[model samples]
Target: MSADTQHSSQFALLRQRRFAPFFWTQFLGAGNDNLFKFAFTVLVTYQLQVSWLPGEMAGLVIGALFILPFLLFSATSGQLADKHDKATLIRGLKLLEVAVMVLAAWGFHAQQVPLLLACIFLMGLQSAVFGPVKYAYLPQHLNERELTGGNGMVEMGTFVAILLGNVAGGLLIAIPEVGARWVAWSCIGLALLGWLASLKVPASPSTDPALVINWNPVSETWRNLKLASESKSVFRSILGISWMWFVGAVFLSQFPAFAKDVLHGDEQVASLLLVVFSVGIATGSLLCETLSRRHVEIGLVPVGAIGMSVFAVDLYFASRGLGGGAAYTLAGFVERAAHWRVMIDLALLAFSAGIYSVPMYALIQLRSPASHRARIIAANNILNALFMIASAVLGGALLQLGLTIPQVFLAVGLLNVVVGFYIFLLVPEYLLRFVALIASRCIYRFKVRGDEHIPVQGAAILVANHVSFVDAILLMAASPRPIVFIMDHRIFRIPVLGWLFKLAKAIPIASQKDDPATYERAFAEAERVLRDGDLLCIFPEGAITRDGTLQEFKGGIMKILEQQPVPVVPVALQNLWGSFFSRIEQGTAMVRPFRRGLFSRVGLVAGAAVAPENVSPAGLRERVEQLLAA
Candidate 1:
């Protein structure tokens, strides 16, 4: 990240050369694609009223046409992205967009539905190729700290562009006399602009320049899926993201019917719903950077999932008695209080969608191997396409059973809960992050300083002062990566805390004198964790403070470092001594609720890493003491 982007708004990316051009190019491409598709759909459904394509099926046909290429060509596209410079691929894709728009312009002017449909497939193909390059290009440029914010901006921009494109298309096609001509010109103009913007995108070098192109879509797509599945976290995160798209597709595809039948609203009212949804997504996307504190935090995923389900289910109840016979205009809809609940529900559901998707994208980018990252993203695209198709099919089937639109909404919302839990259970990291986030953000107003001293990768030992029973949880929140805590065996016996730690795979140790076998087993597990290049944290004070004071530093950390020889980082937990989870009330922890009240300010400060040879029990304690004092 540049100095401007360190803690500043993500918009700072717009002022820089590396990101701005790419952003605009992507923005224009998405806008142009939607503009062209929406305008054509409107023409077929309202203006032409062709016998071959009925008005009711126009949107579905157009959507299917647009999504077809993703299923067929994503594998090849991912390979091309890895085999060639992304900027070059992007520029070529933009030029292809220009050509496709030129054809679309001709189709629009001639009222040639077949030609326009072909252009839709072509546009989808262009977008499909661009997808991998788009995500793969990010990790190559932005650091880990910038990934969440950068992905957030891209997601926000995409949704905003979609909204603007739909609005522009609707308005342009509604023009009198030369409406088709206007749509044609606008599409062509946007394509040209996209190509112009692509010209300024900086060169992004290929990650796998020598890779052979795989022409077989089926086989290559299978290969890509296999590649992604090799990394359990990345593969599961992909599924989580696809499931979100599934939920979103169900909600979005139902909106027109939802507004017309359920809300008894006019076209403008439907547009209002769209505007609200888009704005919500944009707001949620931008919120990730601040919520994650500039890291690729997966914790927000569960929060988003819960909010999505809650608001969606609420929307069903809110709209149950809404539609009878009164068709309300946009202004009338806003004036009604009951309708406002519906609007708020839609906005929050969309917002939760935004929050749900961005971190998963960031996590996928951060974890995927650079050499094959684009391919992994390609696998994700394939899954997304399938999940969306499933959503549409399933939603349609439910409605065909005579279910009301609001009932369909209720079903999907309820289904989301099951899906969210299933994914979280499969990928325990997500659930763990949720717990850590709740502890850090809700239970306490937690903050961290000098967190950059913690390595983003490889083996390292985090030695911290154990001030409370939940210190490990707070420590997990402090760092972007997972930490395998070597905790006292006694803490593992606590009711809910023990279960949580077991889920986190926390290694529990007893005093050597009390249980020598458990002590040795804990050391063996800790060593294995470090040897696997994972972070290992130890409360070197051996126990939580009984008197709100630091205990004598233990030599256990030095014993581990002697074998691993990894850098040892000193960490201090401040203001946690008197908290509810700490042993401050009569030297017993968790005895009284709200002992420090809620959201008490507490902090974890990490100091510079000491070389293995330079680490000692006293020296590390001094560093922790200094950090606590600071």
Candidate 2:
């Protein structure tokens, strides 16, 4: 089949039943999270008269209950996911959700606030355990090409769920007849529905069946966290994801107060702020697939962070003009729509969050080893939980120390700038891209075709002919998204290029004898990248051609294909041979005088995609040769 047709066919598979059920299950999980929390917040703020615990303290308690599970159970969940059938594990978790809901019902009926909070904590436990399985299950069901779109849909669904759930929770609790009980019952129903959906998921074979389960939460958590930190890109991605949670936790925790004191809105209006935020996240999540053009583009992370800071600072000013104690009904909110600045802040915040999170999720997935992919994800959850908890404490402390909610928003927003700058500085790959992008426009003219062969957004494997040492950099520069290159371990150690590749999060592999473990790790990392919907680029020939001609494809690509049949976009780098970095005249140094005006024409020819069925080492080599010849 033609590459275009092949690419389209692979994407269609993602919409099928085997994948959709699991997607919905995760979607509902996120939705239920917000739904229950919103309901609890309403209960604390309006129904319960707690003179002992201040409002901010109550908010902190709710936040803690939700995050505590990640700290306690995420490590164990990762082991469970690696050792068991993911489908069965997910179904079991769903059943546990039912019991948790029953406990929630008891809390609502008894008017026992602490019991309700305990139930929330239990719910967080269930979610924390489910986190690893949610991520690990994807590579089992999806092809590489579909990973990005699949992840994008899940993220989008999650935010949509958050929006709907928050809205429902608020509306349900405000009802006069059965406020708290009604919300509890609704949560229960949703949990059951999530279980039903999970039942439809196909069985997923364990990658590590003999893995010993670690029972001790603290030590196991530390071990998993260390595993995540071992890889540079994986480590940075975790930090990026954790920072997002930190920023989000701060903003979300303060929204109720912001709406009440600043916007002068009641419970309904406060909920609307959440709704706007969730809507923005949903919008951004959906747009990720398009904006990234289906590749893992970390550049978008910076873009998202910038928006987050800008809008957050603007929100403080926006609140200044909102006046005080001006409550509005649902209908009144529409009538007095002059408070649209709040809407802008909410939308931008969510949108930036979407941009920031999609790539980080993709990056972690791409950079982690498959054998321990879920564990790494669990580690990420652990850190996310920790950061979120800290955000709550920090935000609360600031407020108690006499900072207004709007001022807290400004502080967090400003802090985001500092944090973002620090991360970029530490990992200059993002900065290099900005430099490369500017350089590409000025140095050499280039064009990309058949970019559609790449997924509109999600995981894909880019197979390019390696004509020069800078093949990966050139591809990274040409493509709109970030490309995770699989490199010779030796190339990864090159002085300047090595550091650049490290910063770019390139995966380095070696032959079995040199390092069998590293070789296995390379493929495992590639699998994770595919699972996260990030781009994985490998020189199928395994090394750059000495004579600027495509070589035979290597079986490593085949091994990756076996694990995940992601769409493979064949890229040919044309006319880059005579450049300064190119291997001109058997690699004799061309370093000094020729470097200044040594600009050369470069062309990135993106041929149609090749499906897994159509790809073999021989066939892929021949196909790449043809593209290069063109």
For residues 154-177, what per-residue lDDT tens digits would candidate 1 score against the true structure?
999998988888778867886877
Model 1 misplaced regions, further than 4 Å: 1-5, 324-328
Roughly what TM-score does model 2 have, to 2 decimal places?
0.76
TM-score of each: 0.96, 0.76
Clashes of 1: 0
Model 2 lDDT tens row, 1-630: 344523553235456776778877887877787888888887777667787756656667798778998988999999999899899999999999889888888887787888888888988999998988988877667544455666677787888888888889888888886888888788888888998999889889898999999899889998998888888768887888899999988877776666666777778987888889988987887776665545566667777888999999998887776645558766676566567877888799889999888867876776577889999999999999999999988988898899988889899999999999998887676666654544454565545556656664678888888776677776876675567889998887678778888877789999888899999999999999998888899987777667766677878888998998888888788876666556657663336435536344677778788877888778777777777677
Task: Tell me how far the alpha carbon of residue 408 in candidate 1 is from the true structure, in angstroms, after superposition.
Answer: 2.1
- Model 2: weakest 10-residue lDDT segment is 1-10
RMSD of each: 1.7, 8.5
